[model samples]
Target: MSATTTSPRISPVNPALATPTDLSSEGVAAIADQLRDLLADVFALYVKTKNFHWHMSGPHFRDSHLLLDEHSDQIFAMTDELAERARKIGGTTLRSIGDIARHQRLRDNDKEFVEPRTMLAELASDNQELTRSLRAAHAVCDEHQDVATTSLIENWIDETERRTWFLSEIAGPR
Candidate 1:
């Protein structure tokens, strides 16, 4: 005798998880795609920031460490807001770290050691790139008339700019 095995059947679309929205399906798709990519970049930066924080060492180690810790916290906080925003608009989000890797546009650092100034400089550049991405996402929201997402992106752009400014100041002319 042989036991029969079957895989659970799933629907092509899960209406239950899809929140109600007034936006057109096309708008939802566009917004969701942008948000997913944005979230991916945010997550990548967060990890890199934390990595630098953990590995920070220098004359100003304490200050640099604290700064990166703060930056990482701020970056991590956005993950939930972004994911939820996508869901609120009748869309899905990333499922795993691999999903994030697949969507992220930011580069990761895997060096055994990174100079404190170098870390600061790299993070600053990444934050600048993030600001650009935020603007792009905001443009999508504008096209879709997504005021809620636009508002969120505006605040995020400010925060990203602040992060970039701090990193640059700390890194200084080196």
Candidate 2:
């Protein structure tokens, strides 16, 4: 008997994320690639929210602080959801800061601090990116015939959009 192991980096290396239906090697590979990207996007958003929560300052100090705290928590929760979903799909999450740094489309919060409006704008932008990514994930799931994941991602996209709308509204009529 011979045993050969898969490349862990190729994803879904754990049973928790078994493909909804057994997929072709090529389908698995493609789905895994998208899952990796989505994981990176989520991690980046989580980190960005945390960063803004810590460094934001200005007139809305108390309110902004509280909101950021809640927002960061939401992002963190999304991170867990993403990782578990990746596993459910037989894809491993790319969950390092380095991975996020490399794959994130959003800009880093490089400054030591930012004004309330800056924080709001940054947060909204990241949410928009996340929404777009989730929508794309829905499309991928549909393509893969994975209605379960598609439904999950559709909810995520809507939630992100609601959050983005709130943040954008607070930032004022622009």
For TM-score, the strongest prediction is 1
Which TM-score value belongs to model 1? Answer: 0.92
lDDT per residue as tens, model 2, 1-174: 000112323533556545564765545555566666777777777777778778777777788788878877876777677677666656666757787677666667778767778778778878998787777666666776767677778777887888799788777655
Scanning candidate 1 in windows of ten residues, the lowest lDDT window is 1-10
In candidate 1, list every pair of residues with a backbone clash: none
Which runs in model 1 stand beyond 4 Å of their true positions? 1-13
Candidate 2: residue pairs that collide? 12-90, 12-91, 12-92, 17-87, 17-88, 17-90
Alpha carbon lDDT of each predicted model: 0.88, 0.69
Clashes of each: 0, 6
10 residues in a row with least lDDT, candidate 2: 1-10
Q: Estimate the overall C-alpha local distance difference test score of candidate 2.
A: 0.69
Off by over 4 Å in 2: 1-21
